[model samples]
Target: MTRRLLLSHLSLMLLVLLVLEVPFGVFYARSELSRFTHTAQQGALTLAEVCEEKMEHGLSTDLPGLARAYGRRTGSRVSVVGTNGVVLADSAAQAQALVGRNVSAEPDIATALRDHPVAGTRSDASVGGDVLFVTVPGGSDDTVPCVVRTVYALGPLKAKVHATWIALAALGLGVLAAGALIGFALARSFTRPVRALERATAQLAEGRLTDPPTTDHGPPELRRLAASFTKTASRLQHLLQAQQAFASEVSHQLKTPLTALRLRLENFEPHLAPCAQDSLDQALGEVERLGRMVQGLLALARLENSAIRPESVDLGAVVADRAAIWAAFADEQRVGIVVADAATDVRVRAVPGALEQIIDNLLSNALRAAPPGTAITLATATAPGEGGRTPAMAELHVIDQGPGMSEAERHKAFDRFWRAPDTDHDGTGLGLPMVRQLARAADGEVTLEAAPGGGLDAVVRLQRADARTHRQRPGGSADADCAGNARPHGVMAARGHP
Candidate 1:
């Protein structure tokens, strides 16, 4: 963004400089040329007047000497030509070579012979370079009129013009440089405030509600925006806190009545008819389902509202331990639970109990969905670090040989209270949502994909625990290691029911 801003500023400056400098340079060159030409013409006219006085007695014998003297004085070539196109005298050339040489072929001399003063520029072999010439009639009698011509070197005039242009070009470059420096400073001033806002926004997204940025710096618009953002963040933080508190209180309040109703129904069950007893049992089941839902609601509120500090967890050991706990239940349902032996220890950073809850939810859903004689596989592997700057990630995959969801269904599977249609299993629809929420809270992610040969693969990716953290923990005991630690209290005590 800064580069783009700088380029845009420089481009505009260059365009403006070109617009102003190009025409000014052309005009300056033309003005200098005209001034030099006019000066040469005036000098030739004055010299013609002087020669006219001397030639009143007819073309003087010492005219060549006079012309040579004038040429030396003015740094120009002077020549006298007769009306008959014969050279009378030459200054820069030898008199013997030019005494009778016709110069009437030259445009300036021809014009002067016709009694008109003329000035022009052309290449001249006698001058050995291009020269500017001015010719004027010089004799008293028109019939015996002579032309006095002056030739000035064009090289020196052109050099002067070029020097002016070079100076102008240097000035233009200096202006552009100044403009660039000023533009960059201005751009930085504008972007500094934006960068600060960006950092504040990131902190807000990470649920850090403290230390809102001050609006005392930057442009007025940005300052107002920062102030507004601070107010909005405070309001949003308060609202979420209130909602979480309300939900927790309501869930806690509902639990006591639900438990009491269940006890009452159980006591009244033995005194009723068999049909009534079945109805009472159904009521008790419904009450239990409601109770589980309230518990889920409470858990969801807590997970969303609480900030959990992350710690290193051995992913492979966790998988093995979870698989072992679910093995008996899997056998009762005619399904097998398999834990793969990892080649290397895979560890990740997550909140305490976060990984356990994620595993329990996924395992419970898998057990409910897997068919008889099918196997559920829990495995851990290390994913390569992104850009090789971050540490490698630990991925825990739970593969179930069950009726997997379609692409469309998988997209909505994580929504609270959402469930697949036509499924026989009971679920509160909060399990996947809870799993996703907990994963994200730990700076991790969970995804569902169709497994090979028809099943669902639930994959969770978390940042790999640093080597220093791993070294700090007790090592070398499989059963008591990072993965095999005791389960989080009440992690899966209340199974989700729809």
Candidate 2:
């Protein structure tokens, strides 16, 4: 969460910098070029005035020396041209040879000779690059009309502009770095309370009570939310404790009476006449079924009352082990427990022993309904997502070749103590509800489907260990796929609808 927040902050900062700095840098570059051109033109006009004064005072003999001195100081090529298009003086090394050369066709010199200023850029071979030229009319009263021309190389000006752009880019980068640091700090501050709330919620779902986050020193809204959540969790904790205590008390209160009733009825078994023996048997059966129902309810209450977190489980290994244990019992009834080869290598997140209990209940239910010489198949497959919006899930199917329920019955099966009207086998119907709760505890789900071969399919869809959050219990195996992978094993005593 912090990373996402920081990235969003930095992205906005970069966009702002680009919007502002890009135009500013472009404007500065163009403005710098304009100012450099203007300065050169002004300098050329001043030099022209100096030349006019020297010519009017009869100092034309030192014209070349004046031009040379000006060029040396300003890093420019200076030239004096006569109105008749002859070179009067030049600052170049060949000035002496070109002192009287006719240069009237030269564009800048010709324009200046006609009394108009010349200012712009053009390619210059002598400098091996572009140059800025400024020419101005000078000394019209001289024996020969004259002009002054100045040529300055643009390399240094362009270099300065490029350096300024680099500086702006560097400054933008520094600002972005600073923004990232500040954004990270701010994101952490806000998400600290969120993290605490998440952990507390998970604990509360697992039947544990936890205090709300106290270090919620972030925004005012988050602080208020924390306080409200803490209050609600506290209230819920009290309610759960009271309910658990009630269930425990009720179980304790009824156990002796139920046991005594069953025993008292059995004591009458030998004394009762043989004609009334059938009545006695039915009475005993009802008491025994009632006792089982009570135990099933207590199992469900305990399942809800305990605090337990889900972790990664090897779906393949679990199915194989459970199937093996149930195989001997299945064989005695002329039924088979088959674990499909495709069921291997499946890892999913589930409540610690919830898969075993789910499997056992489903298998026990299947065994009761399945006919002799039939097989119960344990299969697993990966369920694909819908357009990548839904995450993939690991599906464990406990399939039985037995009488299947209709859609309405399947829908009602998950309800506590619900059984189909036609069901003849003894079951309290707590198993499906318990199975669903266990699946949900791991952020998964469960459903009942009619098998293609006209049987029941108990489909448990669990989160793929990699697709959802999970943590290994201390000392648990690191890899669930290894041949020697070990985990705690147990069979919970709860049977499903037959």
Candidate 3:
């Protein structure tokens, strides 16, 4: 953006300079040419008068010497021509070779011989260049006239004009340079404030509202904009604070009543008949599901409002530990859970507990969808970055043999409150959304793809942890040492479960 503004400013400055300078330069050149020609013509006329007087006094024999002297003084070629079309004298010693030669055919000389004065400039092929010629009729009245013609080379006149133009061009260049420098300074002044505002806006979007723009620098308009931005950020921060507080308050208030209702249902369970007891159990299940939904909502709110501080964690270790904890639940559903033994100790950078929550949600979703006798596989591996180079990402995949969703369903699956059209299991529908939020907060991403064996594959990718911190286990690969003591504990109650 700064470059564009600078270019635009320079372009406008150059355009203005061209518009004003081009015509002035052309007019200046023509004026100099006209003034030079006029002076030469007047000099020629004065010399013609002197020659006429000298001829009347019978001093025509001295005409060549007079013309030569004048030519030497003026740096011009002077010639005296008889009315009968013959060269009488020539001022230039080289031109003396044409003495007594017929030369009245020359346009300026012929006009002077007709008793008319002529002054103009023309390209003279005989002279090998352009020359300014002026001729005047010589000799007193009643005597046969002679022509005195003066010729000046146009080269010097043109050189003077070109020099003037060169000077003007230099001046124009200086002005353009000055204008460019000033324009660049002005452009920086404008864009610097805009860039500051851009950075501040990005920080605000990332939930950092404490450091708003100072609102005292830049132009008045930008200062006003910065002030407005600060106000908007303050309002948005307050609104989010109010929302989080309300969610916390409502969740806390409802938990006590929910607990009492659950206790009451359990108390009546033994006295009721089998059909009533089954209904009571179903009601209790619904209440439990409601409780989980409230907790999920609170977690989502907190995750959205909070910033995640990342730390290095072993991806393979977390996956193995989570799979072990879910193993018993999988057995109850007749669905086998398997953690790839090769994935034991790969590490990544993520918010604390973020990976655990993601694993719990994915495993819960997979277990609920998997059919009896099917298997749910948890594995960890490294995947290439955008450029396919290492220190690649650490990816965890939860693959299950279940009814995988279609492409359209997968796209909308991450939206809050979204659910598949026909699914057997009950869900709060916030599972995928919460998982995605947690992944993003941890500087990671989660995606779903159709597994090769006709089930959903949930892949979570996190930034790879620095390899320097990892210590290889003795007699085993760092990623292949999955001892029971390495298991993480209390994995069943991790948040983000639905």
Candidate 4:
């Protein structure tokens, strides 16, 4: 972001310089050449008048000296020609060889002899480069008809223009550099406060308000936002605290009475008639169910209000351990427990105990729905990523040979306490919701699908553990050693867990 901001500044600055400086530079060069040519033309005409005066007084022998002096003063080569285009005087070092040359064939001399000034630039072999030439007629009857031609080398003027362009480029670069510095400073000013706010938001999400955003820096709007956020965060913290307290109070106030009532009802079992005993058992059963319902409610409250951060765990090990533990339960019901794909070194990210609970709840539901001849399958696999654009997902699947839910029922299965119409168990309906919350906490999800063989396939999708997980953790093998300790927040009903 800082780089982008700096580039933006430099781009704008370059555009402005190009728009204003380039035209000014071009115009300056053109005007300099024009002024230079005009000066040379006027100088030639002045020399013509001087030469005419010298010739009329019969002092033409001093014409060469006059031409040389003017050439020295103006940094140009001068030549004086008579009306017949004969070169009378030349400022060059080889003047003796040129005193009789240029009798009248040269364009500038021929045209100037007709009393017209000729001025232009062209390459000159004698000068070894380009030259600006100006020839003007200035002789009259008071003296003799003659034309003065001035030839100035263009190297100095070109060098001056090139130097000017360099200076302009240097100035543009300096401006861009200064702009980059200012832009970087401004970017830091804005992003620093934003980063602080981001960290604060993360802490808030974790139910920890350790570091709050400071309202003293950045722009005015950011300051106001920080102030507003502080107020709102304070209120949210208070509400969360109150909600946790309410859940605790409800747990404390309700558990003791429910236990006592159940015990008191059981005590009447031996004192009453068999018919009355059945009625008492039903009442006690209702009390037990109510107790479970209360536990489910508290679990939900805890999940809703707790800090949730996922950690890496061995997915295959968790699946294997859970399958082994639930094997006995299945045996009691004469239902087979089949463990599949649970021996791989599959690592996944999940809450510390979440994978275990997610597996447990799913297996519990599966076991309940399975018949004596049916089987419950616990499996692990990696769902392939979107080409290489995404990481592969660790998937834990609990499949049971039972009547599966329809598409509509599957969609609603994740809701609190939702059960199929045909289910007979006493469930508090918080199981799947807790499972989903736990999965989401781990940056994953839970879904239900129809098994290939007409059973419910409950899948818990999880992120594959980071490849650097081993190097990042203190004990590299922690996930493998602590497979059973996978924590899923608040998915346990009073009945499903051991």
Candidate 5:
């Protein structure tokens, strides 16, 4: 797989090289041909001028001498032609073809007769082929006119251009090969680090972060990632060890009271008076409280050991159901309970039971601290951000109008067994901590703030459900809107009717 990946990258690089170099090679070859044509034309014209001088003197007066001299000087075939297109003097065709013979139909010669010397490249069988032809008319005073023509063979130029093309083709192939090699090296360099990281993550998932990794060589980012994974693994190992220790200690602490409560119950038949029964009931309540504490401790341990799985839930109904259960307890304590009607349809994504437990714990704590006539405010709604289409999330706030905690107390509120110093009320003091654990486990968060005027306020925030899962039922109450006391909140706000 790795080799295939590297080869794929190399192939792409080679393809790009081909795209850029092919046209450039063709264009460069054409440019060299153009330069060759220009240089040949200039030399041919110079030879034509000299040949015209020889033509003016005729055959007896050094015509061959001048033509031979001109041909030798310019490296071209020099010839003279009369106005009737007959070859008069020649340098290459053995200077003997001096008779009248019409040769005006030749493309290059005919063009030069009517216009400036028609200098261009042409290929022919005789005279070493592929030559530049140039013809110029010459006379003394426009009375007797003759044309001098020169042909410079471009065989050497063509040979050099062909050789250059071969060399460039080789160079282009080399460049493509070199690019593929470089690309292969780079792909290997990049993939090696990622493959190492993948193996490390697999080990970590299997709880094997106790030892360090073997290979630590790669780019800086990969090195940093390895370091981070090692650190995380170390921390997780320590945390698991700590949780096991805590679980053991908590279990030991709860066992003695549980044994004592069971013994007391077993021996209670001998003391069955009304007053004795009442005292025994009070002892049983204490035993139940201890059991609840142990259960909460187990829940906390499980939270540390487990991972979060988030899903949609309606918090409004969770609050209302909790309020209903606590309403009976609230009445017994002479406290007024009010579950706000407005939150009946609000919903958010979270663990269903965990969120309910958080709500229950917070409400239980609030009821303990709240005054008799004070109302506990349970509200649910969606929170809006600065900009964008979707609302941020759904929020559920449980407010109590009791005496609020000090800043110091608020900070310590979620700590296990760290209740406020002033309160003489008996409790396991694990309520708030358990609430926090459950909130975090549900991929949600919990915050404590001062209630309106003064009191404890517990707020839970979570993501809203997708639109497909949200449906409005007109006559439905909070009970029906939420599944198991959890309902939708963030969606209700998005319809602009919040």
Candidate 6:
């Protein structure tokens, strides 16, 4: 980018320089040529006056010698012509060829006959080639019988003009080169900070949040940008480290009290009446629930730190395991838990523990909202690949015959700490969001929709694992089947679903 900017700056500079310099240079060279021509014409007029004085004093015999002397000194062809426009003498040319020439017919000669110097520059196809013609009347007396004319070739002046143009072009090129170098340096200085920021951001994403950038060069804007990014990175690092510390501290602190509570409960069991036992049992349940929440929080924090480690797992087997875990709980709630495709040969690449946790959370939430005796289905199917030609993907779906979510609710379902207003259960509200994060880490996706009958359907789509070691047993472990069912405890249904 910096190189591109520098090149652009250089191009504009060169364009502007060319616009201003080319015309002005040409005009300056022409003006110099005009000045030289005008000076030569004025000299001729003065020389004509000198010749007229000599002629008046009876030195007309000396006209040829004077013309020759002046013409040789100034590199001009000088001639003296009589009043009738007849050449009297000539220098640097044969006198006889010009002596009888009718010079009055020539425009400059005719103008000179009027007692004024005919002065201007012109190019012509003359034998002398590209000449400057200047003619002047003899003396101050208009009656004088002579005029002086000077001719100069334009070739030397043309050479000087060409040289001046070349010099000007060279100077402009030098200026352009200097400007380009300066612009490149400036562009590099400006973009350096931004480049550092990019690298630092990449590092932060890769979990290297501690090492910060130390670039502070270029313009004030760049410095400020670098400073802002550094500050933000520092703040983020502190916040994450603090959260990790807090999670650790909270977990440690809760364990000590939970252990004490369990000991107290054991003591109460020895001295308890039947009523007291029930109260103690309920207290134990609350304590255990709190312990689970803390454990969940710790797990969530760790997952946030670094998740997405995936491995191949049999999708069918995974589905069966989830089904077995939830079946007993679903039965207790008077709801049927069905595991479909449990006998199929399907596989997926994902974090098994995380996938199971997501299934458990979704099932748990669904069972709480579902009517008793309604059947909850855990199903697995293969997804079609690109162009409908590649290997099928593994799709795990949990559908409950529970109250379905509204569109607006579905959109917010994956937001952390988001719970539908109609939900009447104890929930941390982190479940769905955690599930989504895990799914994303595994290079997969999770979505929720309305079940066909009237309930929420949660679906997880994952890349299919290799089918090299697939096994299809008629019956698998009961624990496998229990993995996707929810246990109802009064109004709040909970437990790890498939």
- Whose lDDT is greatest here? 4
Better by lDDT, candidate 5 or 1: 1
Question: What tens digits encode model 6's per-residue C-alpha lDDT throughout 161-229?
Answer: 888888998999999989988998888987887777777887776555555666557678778777888
Q: Give the whole-model CA lDDT for all candidates, comma-separated.
A: 0.75, 0.77, 0.75, 0.78, 0.64, 0.72
453-475, model 4: which lDDT tens digit per residue? 79888888887885322211111
The ten-residue window of minimal lDDT in model 6 covers 472-481
Off by over 4 Å in 3: 1-10, 104-131, 135-144, 173-196, 214-223, 246-276, 308-360, 373-401, 405-412, 438-498
Q: Model 2: which ten-residue window has the lowest total lDDT? A: 474-483
TM-score of each: 0.69, 0.81, 0.70, 0.84, 0.57, 0.57
- Runs in model 5 with CA error above 4 Å? 1-34, 58-253, 261-294, 341-346, 384-391, 467-498
Q: Kindly give the number of clashing pairs for every candidate.
A: 3, 0, 0, 9, 11, 19
Better of 2 and 5 by lDDT: 2
- List the candidate 1 regions with Cα displacement exceeding 4 Å: 1-14, 84-88, 93-131, 135-145, 166-196, 213-223, 244-291, 306-332, 337-360, 377-399, 405-412, 421-426, 438-498
lDDT of 2 by residue, 1-498 (tens): 988999999999999999999999999988988998888888888888887788778888888998999999999999888668778889989557988989889887877777888899998888989998898887544343688888899899889988999999999999999998899999999888888878777766656655567644778888888788888888988987898788778887888998999899989988999999999988887787777677667666666666556677998888888888888889988999988866457788776777776777777777876889999999889976666566668898888888888888888888887877767766667667767766666667788899997988889898777673443221111112111223222222222354
Candidate closer to the true structure by TM-score (higher is better), 1 or 3: 3
Tens-place lDDT digits, model 3, residues 48-139: 77877777788989899989999999889999887787887888887788989998787777777878888888887767899988888875
Q: What is the lDDT of residue 277 in candidate 2?
A: 95
Shift in Å, residue 160, candidate 2: 3.8
